[model samples]
Target: MKHAVTVRNVEARPTAVVAATTTWREFPALWKPMLDEVWACLRAADIHRGCRNVMLYLDDTPRVEVGVELTQPCPLTGNVVSSSLPAGRVAMTVHYGSYAELGAAHDAVIAWCAKENLSRTGVRWEVYGPHDDDPAKVWTEICYQLS
Candidate 1:
């Protein structure tokens, strides 16, 4: 399946994210608990503070490294935490489908970046949007900053 892609220049704002670094194969299993926690925190923070999307910023390292950062906290964590992502030019794309398909979306974005002669900087973030009861219906945005 193909989805429309958009490239935009975005500023990185400080956000409360539950971050975890792991290999590609281990990401899925590790992300579940962290994402669940992030959701709970967002719910507790109320609608206003709740994140509209989750971001996965891929780090530019030789080794295969991925960082999963939550836009909002899990309801259980009452603390309001925020981190600033350095502002820069980024290639943005929206993926509409099951969370499982997000990887493909990222691959597409990477390919797009290469085609445009753009290099990635720090970790690529998988930004998550509002809470969708069904994960399949959730809309996530994958953004990778240009190097």
Candidate 2:
């Protein structure tokens, strides 16, 4: 399916993430637990979340950072760490379907970047929106940093 791609500047956002190194096929299994861990930490720390769930991917090996955007950075330890999503130009596209179909949205953004002669910084992430009983109604924003 054709995707509507947009280019915009996004400000840096602070996040507390649980980092993991896993293959694409194992991502969901590993990340679900990590996401739960992150939320638990936030609750324990009494930190207010400012934005949606974000999963930053550094490569195809999929070094994943399961994170929740925070109003401010809070101290974290052990497997969970604090980081910021970089501020800069980005290529964005929304994926409207089940998580299983998200790869198409990623492909669309990468193709769009290539067509536009935009070089990517190899930092990409997905911002998850509200969940719906109907998978078709689910929304996720695929964002790629542009260089």
Candidate 3:
């Protein structure tokens, strides 16, 4: 499916996350269990968890933080620690379908940025929407930081 890419400013948000370094292919197996760890930590801490999940990618490495947005800044709890999504301008697009095709959304953003001569900052993230029983109803927002 064709994705419409847009540029916008986003604020830093506090999150409870589990950091990991894994290959792109290996990440699919890690995200769910990682998020589960974060969720358990949040529940034990009596913190409210947001409805969406996020996976923040670092600029310099394969490391990623898979977790949920926090309602407020929180202290470290177990391996689930305090981290914030950097505030900045980003090229964003929402992939409206199965998670299997989410990479196409990222590719769309990459192509859009290149066509517009916009340089990416090497950092990016995916905000996963609530899951659905039907694969066609899933949506994930891909955001790449802009330089």
Candidate 4:
């Protein structure tokens, strides 16, 4: 996959997330079930979702938070909690295709950072596009914090 990475200052965005811990191999199994709970919480609270679904990876140990952006923070209930996408300089790229193919985008960003001699914050997140059957049309913004 071809990627063009860019460095930009990002603005912090509030999100309603459900945190989960799993290995890389178990991610596919974990996200859908977590997102179901997220949706149910949103529905029960009568909250309209904001932007794309975001999965933020917190560390190499693979702690992840899966949730959608909300216009503003809501009262917390159950496992859904309010969080913010970190702001600051980031190495960013857009990945086009299946979720299974997302690793290439991450690799591309890391390589770009290395080439640019940028320091990493070890924080990464993906903003996913609308559900689609066509892999080519699916869009995901892959971002890694630069520090």
Indicate which candidate wins on lDDT.
Answer: 4
Which stretch of 10 consecutive residues in model 2 shows the poorest summed lDDT?
A: 43-52
Candidate 2 has which clashing residue pairs, if any? none
Cα-based lDDT at residue 94, candidate 1? 78
Best by TM-score: 4
lDDT of 1 by residue, 20-57 (tens): 55665776576566655555666565734534445454
Q: Write the per-residue lDDT of candidate 2 for residues 13-129, one digit (tens) a residue.
A: 888899888988898678888988888777777764555798998777888789777766566766789887778999999999889989899999999999999999899988898
Per-model lDDT: 0.61, 0.85, 0.86, 0.87
Q: Model 3 over residues 9-126: C-alpha lDDT tens digits?
A: 9999877789988888888799889988888877676765454789999954678998988876555577787787889999999999988888799999999999999999899998
Off by over 4 Å in 2: 46-51, 72-77
Residues 40-68 of candidate 4: C-alpha lDDT, one tens digit per residue = 88877777555469989898779999988
lDDT of 3: 0.86
Query: Where is the poorest 10-residue window by lDDT in model 3?
Result: 42-51
Best-first order by TM-score: 4, 3, 2, 1
Deviation in Å, model 2, residue 45 alpha carbon: 3.5
Residue 75, candidate 4: how far off, in angstroms? 3.9
TM-score of each: 0.67, 0.86, 0.89, 0.90
Q: Best to worst by lDDT, what's the order?
A: 4, 3, 2, 1
The superposed Cα distance between candidate 2 and the true structure at residue 75, in angstroms, equals 4.9
Please list the residue runs of candidate 3 whose C-alpha ends up more than 4 Å from where it truly belongs after superposition.
46-49, 72-76
